[model samples]
Target chain A: SAVISQKPSRDICQRGTSLTIQCQVDSQVTMMFWYRQQPGQSLTLIATANQGSEATYESGFVIDKFPISRPNLTFSTLTVSNMSPEDSSIYLCSVGDRGSDTQYFGPGTRLTVL
Target chain B: DQQVKQNSPSLSVQEGRISILNCDYTNSMFDYFLWYKKYPAEGPTFLISISSIKDKNEDGRFTVFLNKSAKHLSLHIVPSQPGDSAVYFCAATPGVGNEKLTFGTGTRLTIIP
Candidate 1:
């Protein structure tokens, strides 16, 4: 079990603006992932943040809309570009520990784009 | 395509009774399954997991049953307690190193004391 934390626990932003959520882990991890949970919906994988490289987006998501940065093994960030009301959801960061198949999640950032 | 599905939206059980949560997956490629419990304003906590090779796995009062032939799995909590009340989510992964996971719509479990 890894201790994960995300900045901007909850926020409200105007449409067209972008909000960047930062994720930090207590220890180094090989893989970090970002997920989105819309209201009354299941969790959807947004992207896989790889250190020193570009992020891998899912089929329905794109890098332009959700750009990610992983500068080190213990830190990463996800920026919701050109936000809209539809983009309002809970964004979570997760880290996979060694020898464990489970991924530990952060408290999650609640973003509301008005 | 929803690879993982939780048909039930909610479930209620009396304290000290058994609570069962069901999940189904359309993808046969998935070999790893996990259950997570979540409370409001908090992140999900890992409960238990089962591998493809095993049909059942147990941890204390929680047991996970996997039926590969039916592409179905279930989590059973025996002697349920009030603290067990939370939203339970089922997730599946294709393999050990696979970073992608398909999650089912969570089922809110309520335990009545």
Candidate 2:
């Protein structure tokens, strides 16, 4: 299992503001992913971040709304742009091992937009 | 469409009993399944996973049983403890090696001592 950490454990922001969540891993990883969990809902994959390439976003999620930056193998950032009430959710980052399929997640950033 | 579905929203289990959480998927392309446990304010923790080629996979007290024909899978936790009380989510991916995962609505398990 990999050790992952995310900045801003919890935050309350005004609507229309933006927040950037950072994820750092202890060791180098090949794949990192961003996910969102809304109230009383399941987790939805936002995007996959790999170092030195553009992030691959799932359908219904766009880079404009959620921009991701993977500068290195152990660090990534996800910025929630133009936040709204619907954007209030837990943002989590996960790192997949180099050869293993199991992914370990960081303590998520809980964002509440009012 | 919701590709993965967990029918039960909550479950109450006595301590030392078995906790069974079920999940179903409509897509047959899903060849890998994983289970995660989430606490109130933390990220979901990966528990166990099973591949389509296998029918059962066990690790310690947690075991995952998959029935590909029915497109259904279940996680069984024997001798449930207080630490086992959390929201359990079942996720699926078409392949392995950190592919995009589709998650199901989690089932909250409460263990009564």
Candidate 3:
């Protein structure tokens, strides 16, 4: 299991603002992913952050809205740009352990855009 | 379309009894299924997982049973405790290279003391 942490555990932001959430892992991981969860809804995959490469965004999500950066193996960031009320959701980062199918998650960042 | 589905919104079980949580998937391509437990204001913690090749996988008091033909799976927790009370989520992935996962709406389980 990996110990993952996210910054700005909860934040209140005004619409049109941007917030960048950081995820740091204890050890290097091959795959890092970002997910969004709405109230009383299932989690939706936002993107896959890969080191030294551009993140791959999922359908209904775009890079311009949810830009990601993975500078190193153990660190990644997801920025919610031009936030809106609809963008309010809990953002989570996860890493898949090498040689293991299990993925560990970070304490999610709860963002409320007013 | 929801690839993964947890039909039950909530479940209540007496302590020390078995608690079963069920999930179904519409996608036959999903090869890995996982269960996660979450508390309020916390990220989900991985509980257990089963591969497409296996029908049953057990760890401690938790067992995951998979029925590929029915595209269904279930998690059983025996001797349930009050501390086991939390929201359980079921997730599925197509395969290794396809890292994306489809998650089902969670089922909140309450264990009565």
Candidate 4:
């Protein structure tokens, strides 16, 4: 299991503002992903952050709206741009195990857009 | 459409009893299934997983049973304890390695002492 952490555990932002959440891992990992959990909904994949390359965004998620950065194997960041009330959700980052299909998630960042 | 589904939103069981959480998936491509436990204000922790090739996988008190024909899988916790109370999410992926996971709506399991 990977020890993952996210900064700004919870935040309340005004509509139209952008918020960037940072994720850090204890050890280097090959696969890092971003996910979102809306209120009363399941976790949805936002994108896969590739090291030193552009991320692979899932359908319904775009780069401009949710920009992701994976500068290295142990760190990544996800930014929600031009936020709206609908953007209020828990943002999580997960690290995929190289040896298995398991993914370990980070303590999520709870966002509230008002 | 949701590829994975957990019909029950919540379930309660008495301590020392068996707790079963069920999940169903529509996508036949999914070959790997996993169960994750999540608590409020925390990240989801991996509980157990079962590959399509295997019908059952067990880890101590946690057991996962898979029925490929029905596209259904369930997690059974024996002798449920209060600490077992949490939201359980079932996730599936088409294959291995870096594949995106499709998660089902979680089932909130409450173990009454």
Candidate 5:
């Protein structure tokens, strides 16, 4: 299992503000993913961050709204741009080893947009 | 529509007993199924997984049973402990290696001590 950590564990931001969440892994990993879990809802994939390449955004999501940076194998960041009240959700980053199918999740950043 | 569904929103069981959580999927493309446990203020942790080829997989106190025909799967925890109290989510992926996962609404399991 990978040890994953996210910075700014929780934050309350005003509407129209942006917040960037950072994810760090103990060891290098091949795939990093961003997910959002809204209140009383299931997890939804936001994007897949690849090292030194552009992130792959899932349908219903766009790059301008959620920009991602995967500069290396052990680190990545997801920024929620021009946030709104609807953006209040738990953001999580997960790391996957190329060897196995398992993906370990970070502690998650809880965002509250008011 | 949600491809994966965990109909029950919450369940409660006594300690030292068995805890069973059920999940169903509508997408036939989903080949891999997984269970994740989440605590408040924390991200979900992978608990167990079962492939379409196998009907059952076990690890220590946790066991996952799959019914491919029904597109249903279940996670069973024996001798449920208070520490087992958490929200359990069911996720499925069509293929392996960086494929997107579809998650179901979680079931909050509370183990009564």
Candidate 6:
């Protein structure tokens, strides 16, 4: 199993503000993904970040609201812009080893907007 | 509409007993299914997975049963332990090499000692 970590484990921000959450993995991986788990809801993918390419946003999520940066295989960042109360959720980062179906996840960053 | 569904919101089981979690999917295209366990403030950890071709997969006390024709799958934890208390999520992907998944609303499981 890969060891994954996220920065700023929890944060409280104000409305109309943006917060950036960083994810780091101990090992290099080809595919990294951002997922949001809203209150009482299932995990929803925000985007897929691959090094040296534009992140692919999932349906109902957009680049403007959740811009992702994948600078290398071991790191990525997700910025939640102009956040509202509804944006309060647990953000998670996951890494998938090439040719494997399993995705390993980092301890999530819990965010709250007031 | 959710492609994957876990109709139960919560389940309680006694330790040393069996804990069964059920899940259903509406998408016929899904070929791989997985179960993940999540603790509070922690990301989901992969539990067990069953490929569509197999009807069952087991590891230790955890076993996953898949009924492809019914679009249903289940996770059975035999001799459940207190540590097994957590939110369990069921997810599915379309096919090989595609890791993208559709997840079901999690079921909170509590194991009473």
TM-score of chain B of each: 0.97, 0.99, 0.97, 0.99, 0.98, 0.97
Model 6: per-residue Cα lDDT over B1-113, one tens digit each: 89999999999999999999999999999999999999998899999888999999999999999999999999999999999999999999987544787899999999999
Docking class of 6: medium
Clashing pairs in 1: none
- Give stretches of model 2 more than 4 Å off: none
Best-to-worst ranking by DockQ: 2, 4, 5, 6, 1, 3
Name the candidate that leads on DockQ.
2
Q: Where is model 5 chain B poorest over a 10-residue stretch in terms of lDDT?
A: B93-102
Q: Per-residue lDDT for A26-48 in model 2, tens only?
A: 99998999999999999999999
Highest TM-score scorer:
4
- Per-model DockQ: 0.63, 0.79, 0.61, 0.77, 0.73, 0.69
What is the Cα-based lDDT of residue B76 in candidate 5?
Answer: 100
lDDT of 3: 0.94
Report the lDDT tens digits of candidate 6 across residue range A1-114: 889999989999999999999999998898899999999999998899979988999889988999899999999999999999999999999998767878888999999999
Q: Which structure is stronger by DockQ: 3 or 6? A: 6
Cα distance off (Å), candidate 6, residue A41? 0.5
- The residue ranges of model 6 lying beyond 4 angstroms of the native Cα positions read none
User: What is the DockQ of the complex in model 1?
Assistant: 0.63
lDDT of 1 by residue, A60-112 (tens): 99999999999999999999999999999999998895467888889999999
The per-model lDDT (C-alpha) reads 0.94, 0.95, 0.94, 0.96, 0.94, 0.94
User: Total backbone clashes of model 3?
Assistant: 0
Worst 10 residues of 5 chain A by lDDT: A95-104
> Which residue pairs does candidate 6 place in steric collision?
none
Point out the higher-scoring one by lDDT: 5 or 6.
5
Per-residue lDDT of A1-114 in model 5, one digit per residue for the tens?
889999989999999999999999999898899999999999999999989999999999999999999999999999999999999999999989665877889999999999
TM-score of 4: 0.99
Model 1 reaches what TM-score against the true structure?
0.98
Which of candidates 2 and 6 is the stronger one according to lDDT? 2
